[model samples]
Target: MMAGTHGQLWYLGMMEENKLKTSEGTLEKARNSEEWRCQGLSTQRSCHFMAFPSFEHVITMDSLCFDSWFTPSWLDEEPARNGFAQDGNRCNDHALPPDATAFVTILRNCAKNKDLRKGTKVHDDITKMGLLEKCSDALVTMYAKCGALSKAKELLELHISRNLFSWTALISAYAQQGLGKEAVDCFEKMQRAGLSPDAVTFTSILKAYGSIGAADKGERVHDEVVHQGLLENDVMLGTALVDMYAKCGALAKARQVFQNLSSRNVITWSALITGYAQQGEAVQAYACYEQMQSEGLFPDAKTYACILKACGDMGAKDKGECIHNEISRQGLLANDFVLGTALVDMYAKCGVLVKAQQVFENLPHRDVTSWSALIEGYAQHGQGEQALKTFEQMQGGGLAPNEVTFTSILKACGALGAVAKGKQIHDEIARQGLLGSNFLLDTALVDMYAKCGALAQAQKVLDELLLRDISTWSALIMGYAQQGQCEQAVTCLEQMQQEGLFPDAVIFSSLLNACSHSGRVHDGHLYFTLLSKKYGIKPDLEHYACMVDLFGRSGHIDKAVGVIQGMPFSDNLEVWSILLGACRKWGDVNVGRWAFEHAIQFDRENTAAYLLMADLYAAVGMHNDAKSNQALRMDNEGLKMLEVVV
Candidate 1:
């Protein structure tokens, strides 16, 4: 290390064993006056370095992400060196200014290493020496790179003589800090300064647009980059353009740009994969991952994480296991707790609980996310005891549960009908002030109470919620439905509509389920109609099955068949099985035959449908027909069917 006074300013550099490394540091000036007190880095302003650790003796600096060519305005502004005349002529009675180049060098080095704590001392010296005018650009670059963004912006705006590098650095920093609008504003100001942005500046601004989902603005930047022909040579810039499009959900355009790129790397592929995974396009994400590997590029940690999420989304347990093995072989799980957490979440979503637990236990470290993944798997799969035990273990390890952990624990409490435990968890959440803040926790609490058959408590919690979304109201209605209060659930539905929340497919399914259980077939039918007509919500398979169940249980076998006939898609096994059960209840042998044939066509191994049809025939005294189905079911090659009695 070297530190000494050069005029009033101190020069310092970092030294490692057998090599000199450039870093920003300064000697603490004695704070004797108010000016010094205001500029003091702190009371302990001295540099703290017992001994510099050895490195490869190769201290590299980041490339300048701005125009390398400078305008000659700086060269033409050299100060006068002669003695001053009476008519305000320039003079040089002062010997000379301390070297500006040395200060700039140290500041640039600080920016490279992000050495801000020491950089502050450098800033303090720069301010005292009145070199702010000459070193404004380097100071801004140092402050911006070191994460002191506000200070960087203030310095840039204060110095009208600022260069392109100063504005570019601030713009890049603002984008990195996720202040997209601010970064855009800074870029606009840069444009107004009559300076053209280079390739790197456009890349950073594209990231800014991506962060805020400003695809339109990003398109303009894309056009500018194209007009300048910068994309032909800069692969990094091309990747940024693709990333911006993907983040804005303009995935079609993103794919077009990605295909047009002459070269691709792991980062470009990761961006595309991340977009697909986040947008719930799991198949596309998985396909992209395979293609990236096929291009002879191995998946990085980020790519693995994205692919694992895709596998979880698709419930592809086999693929997730393959990824798990690949991750283990690469030893990526040893230090990357985030990757470890993703693995736990992947296995858990696949319903491979034992493997999830094994991965979690073997993790080198565990955070709230990893513990939440294990606990959530248990809760989701109906292993309430295991969920509760894991929750306790997480707390025992001195990790306070976050919102995600609480949500999973609440689900476990609900599944086990542990109302007391649910209430205790609710109190803990209230104490932590999580109730009004996150709607997810609110929904979880209401659902927990409702699942435990505590309708009044559930309703009370819903009423008191500071924020209520569809999921929150749906929780209360489903609770009422589960308790067989069909009328109350319907009333809640009307209330939710009055609040301007149209029912989604899930909500409609819940209502239909409640109506079916309580024998309100007409109400269920009305909701099923509104699902498509009024709400414009295309009924999914679950909704269709719900409607079938509703009609079947009410002895409306023809109406159930009508619902199946009107389905725009092909019939599933559950739909046919429900209709067959209705036929058994009503002694409708003709319809039972039709439903049994369709069910077998959809899935030859639909044992539930076979059983229902066979039972209906035997109940109707069609002993021959019952025996025929039983024999056919047994001889159906791979089908496993229970023996029937006729």
Candidate 2:
């Protein structure tokens, strides 16, 4: 009787095994059939299924066999067709698990399918069926696909019981969300939870560290990677390390790491190159690019862009042009804004404005930098009118000029001393709310007004500045000095000193020039002494020239000559000219001869010296001496003074 019961049980088990095999075979065959498609038919899977081959094959096979044979007539009656597969809940109770599994498989497909959305609904239905705990991997995967990382984490904590794929999915989700810090935190928590990181985990976290420039944290991770014996000389990790070090301004360390790379792709080379370029080390940048090509590593669009910028800074126009031709040969010219901009700036800096304008006009989209480059090009060439016209055109193009643009325009105004135009630009800058921009613009405005002989306007901008830099003070001082406003310049100088800002050589030079223009000889001498005594600023040749001019202009011929002779250094042509001019004013032959001889010796080719000596001899009625000096200048040196135009 026991043998009979055992035989009956074996027979029933065999029947169930056959049923399961038939069910699976039917699903596979239906999926593999060529008739399956997503034309006008309302099916869960379609021709788009080809993108996810695994899911497509399974869904097609299951739909063909399960939908027709086992599907309830009520599901077909309620919807036109394919309703059961579309809404997995329409499946009978026995088919629910297979349907849920199918939906999960579709969710895991990386081929970007519209059916993935339906997979989300099926996943929710699976949760309702209480199968989520039983199928933790599937639930975690579904939540990850739907971008419901919190739900994914909840399922991982509650049902996963162990993190194998769960850690990877969670880390990747964090990375995708750009929560790099959160990704690192998750990685640390995973380690605390006793999970060993895989290659994917390390790569993802390394990327996070690189993005945030967490150099110390990245180094720690690198040490852990080496300690774990997971350092496999992978190019991705090397690239990440280079990027991290580069972003951190540790170019030396970046170079060390980059050199240790056993193999480098274009990205590795490009990262190191860009790092050097950004640090203003264009020579190193180009050298690496050359080495990359020598290694037979071809450059892409990004590589070309970086190298072009390096070339521009280093003034390697030949190299830049060669790269330009290469870019054109590669047909990468259309969408390359960086390369285009770099080309414009390169040509502009090289003084090839025509070429720069051509490049600027050809750009598919002209950004602010493009216009700024062209405007600055004109400004630098002293084409102030052209620069102002370009600025107007740029504003008309619906592009508001930035600080750099305004700075260039203001500089042009200063160069031309176009006070009205400068004020208009100042008002426009204020209207655009860029008053508190860099001190460069403020300094430029002050310089413009000062050069235009508008000291009050210059002071207006000066007072509005919250904290003035040295250039601000220098601008106002130079303006007053140039206009012979000695008192005002001295006042500004005092104000500058009271602000605890020590003046440089330019300030002193401007102050001395002001003294000369205003005939403040004593004050000029006192300030020259103060430069050395109070500020330890040894008077340079310019200061000496100003002092000589001060004394010479005041008819102190002997004092001027003494000042030139008493100079710590040998007398230059400027000092002799000042003394000679003073000798002419005072009509002192004794001083004039010495000054003329010294002037000739200091500047052997100075036509002015010859002319001045001849003029002095003529003034004293020494026609013979005058004639001899003139003959020597003409015959011995082929020197001849042309008519002065200005």
TM-score: which candidate is best? Answer: 1
lDDT of 2 at 337: 71
TM-score of each: 0.74, 0.60
Q: Mark the regions of model 2 whose C-alpha exceeds 4 Å error after superposition.
A: 1-292, 298-303, 306-317, 526-605, 619-621, 630-632, 635-646
Q: Which lDDT values do the candidates have, in the order given?
A: 0.78, 0.72
Writing each residue's lDDT as its tens digit, candidate 2 over 1-646 gives 1222111111111122112122222122233343334432223222332212332233344322222212322212322332212334323433434554554554554112323344455566667876665567766755654467787777777763465576777777776677778778878877887888876677777777766778898787767766776656588777877876886678988898888778889999999999999889999999999999999999999998888778878878788788878887887767667677777877776677788888789887677888998899888889899899999999898998999999899889989989999999989888887775778888888888898888999999998888888999999999999999999999999898899999988999999999998999889989988999998998889888888888888888767877787789877888888888877766766788788888878767777767666677667877676666354354444233421200
Native-referenced Cα lDDT, model 2: 0.72
- Tell me how many clashing residue pairs each candidate has: 0, 2
Please write out the lDDT profile of model 1 over residues 384-432, one tens digit for every residue.
9999999999999999999999999999999999999999999999999
Model 2 reaches what TM-score against the true structure? 0.60
Clash list (residue pairs), candidate 1 = none
| Deviation (Å) of 146 in candidate 1 | 2.9
